[model samples]
Each structure stands twice: as C-alpha cells, then as structure tokens.
Target: MRQFYVYILAKHRHGALYVGVTNDLIRRVHEHREGLAPGFTKRYGVKLLVYFEQHATAATAIQREKTMKRWPRAWKIRTIERTNPTWADLYEEICR
Candidate 1:
C-alpha cells in the first residue's frame, strides 16, 4: 500500500513554519534541506522536519496540511512540541 504524509518544517524552534503534504516524505524533506524545493520553505530556510504524520491517501494528507497551515502560530507550535518538545531535526531519524 502507498502512503502520504502531512509534515511541518521549521527554521528552528518556534521559528518560521511550513506545512506540506507529499507521498515521498524522505525525498521531499531532502529537497527542502538542500534548498532544491524552491519557494516559501527554501526562501525562509525552513528545513528542519519538526513533525509529520502518515495518511492512507493523498487527499487526507493534503487536507491535513491545509488545516495545519491555517492554524494559529501558537497552535502549530503546541502541536509540534507535543511530539517534538526539543524541535530536533527529524531528517536523520526518518532516514534511519
């Protein structure tokens, strides 16, 4: 079965945030990290994958991403901190 992802990237703890959805989490995150994805995330240097959740379908993942993008900054931060209090770069973790 295929999977999709809703992910949040940050410049740093409590810094610029970006919400996105993709079927290839690893490749997408890598693109952002390398400044190859272009646009808001690259422009703002939001490369740290702070949070992500999987979904069974792209529609669900995209909807979740849109919902997260509309959330207030504080709510987004709280959501990230709930699972990632330290706001650690999750790229390495996910790669493993």
Candidate 2:
C-alpha cells in the first residue's frame, strides 16, 4: 500500500508549530529547516520534527494534518509529547 505521513515541526524545543502531510518526512523536514521549502513553515521557522503519524493513504494523512493544524497550541503540544516526551530532534529517530 502507498503510505502517507502527517507530521508536525516546531522551531526549537517549543517555538513555533507547523502541520503538514508528505510521503517523505525526512526530506520535507530538511527542506523546511534549510528554508528550501517556502511558505509559513519557513516564515515561522518551524523546523524541528516533533510529531508524526503514518497512514495507509494520502487521503487519511491529509485529514489528519488538517485536524492537527486546527488544534490549539496546548493540544498540539500534548499530542506531540504523548509519543515524544521531550519533543526531541526526531529527524534521526524517524529515519532510524
């Protein structure tokens, strides 16, 4: 099955938040961090990989991304910390 990813990136350990969906989480996050990916993520400096969810289809991932994007800041942080207690640099963890 084709997989999709719903991911969130933050600036520092708790700076800014950005929600997005993609198949290549690592590359996409790298793009945001490097400023190669334009738009709000770049503008807000949301570059730390914080939270992510894998899906069986793009449609599901998109829906999840929207849901996450609409979430309040507190909820977003809670969601992220559920799986990532410290909201550490998940760039390496996601790849491994």
Candidate 3:
C-alpha cells in the first residue's frame, strides 16, 4: 500500500498557514519552498513545514487535509505546537 501525507506550511512563526496533501511530501514541499507551486503558498510565502500527518492512502490524507483547512487558526497552532513547540522548519528533517 502506498502512503500519503497531509502537511501544513507557514510563512513564519504564527504566520499564514497552508494545508495540503501529497504523495511526495518532499517534492511538494520543495516546490512550495522554491515558489514553484503557484497560488496561495507562493503568494503568501508559506514555505515552512511546521506540521504533518501520514496516512495509508491518498484519499485519507486528502480528507484530513480538508478537515484541517476548516480548523480554526488557533486550533492548528496548538496542533503544531503539541508536536513542534518551536514550529521549526521540517524540510531538513524530512530530507533526512
């Protein structure tokens, strides 16, 4: 079975947030960092990976992503802080 990822990117600490789902987490995040994805991420400079969740399938990931997008900003912030209190950029970690 293939895995999928639901991820959140932010412009900076406590900045604009973006929620998305992808089969290639690394590649998708890289495109966002490079300003190549085009749209909300590029326009808002939301390239820092602060949160993510994995699922067994793309459908599950997409459903979770949609749900997260509907979450209040404060709720999202708390979610990120629970696992990543510093809100560190996870691109490097994911690369490894």
Candidate 4:
C-alpha cells in the first residue's frame, strides 16, 4: 500500500505554520529542516514537524492539506497541540 502525508511544520510554539502534502514524509521534513525546501517554509524558518496525518491515497492527503491551509490559526494550533503539546521535532521519531 502507498502512503501520503499531510503535515504541518512550525518555527516555534505559536509561531508561523506551514501545511503541505508529500509521499515521502521523512525526506520532505528533512528538506524543510535543512532549509533545502524553497519558498515560505524556508523564508519563515518553519522547520519543526508539529503535526501530521497519513492517508492511503494522494488525493486524500492533498485534500487534507488544502483543508488545513484554510483553517484558522487557532484551529491549527489546537490540532498541533493535540498531538505535540511540546512541539517536539518529530523527525527523529520518524527516522527511528
């Protein structure tokens, strides 16, 4: 089975947030952390992986990403806090 990820990255607690969808979660997050990814994420330094959801299909992942991007900031914060109250960099966990 294939996997898709809808993810949120942040600069820090209550900081700028970015929403994206990818087939390779670890590599994509690594790119963001290293500032290898261009545009808003690199510009704003939103490299902390605070939230993510997996889907079986790219279409669902893309839909989730779009929905998240449209969410109010508070809602986004709540969503992150729900899974990562400390806003830990989930990269290591996934890498393991």
Model 4 Cα lDDT, one tens digit per residue, 1-96: 989999999999998999999999999999999899999999999998988899999998998899989999999999999989999988889999
The C-alpha lDDT values of all candidates are 0.94, 0.87, 0.94, 0.93
> What's model 3's overall lDDT?
0.94
Flag clash pairs in model 2. Answer: none
Cα lDDT for residue 73, candidate 2: 93
User: What's the lDDT of the predicted structure labeled candidate 4?
Assistant: 0.93
TM per candidate comes to 0.97, 0.91, 0.97, 0.97
- The number of residue pairs in model 2 that clash at the backbone is 0
Pairs clashing in candidate 1? none
Where model 2 places Cα greater than 4 Å from the true spot, the runs are none
lDDT per residue, candidate 2, 1-96, as tens digits?
777999988887767888899998888988988999989988887888988889998888998888888889999988988999988989988778
Which of candidates 2 and 4 reaches a greater lDDT? 4
Give, for candidate 2, the lowest lDDT window spanning 10 residues: 10-19
Q: For residues 4-77, write the lDDT of model 3, one tens digit per residue.
A: 99999999999999999999999999999999999999998899999988999878888899899999999999
lDDT score for residue 75 of model 4: 97
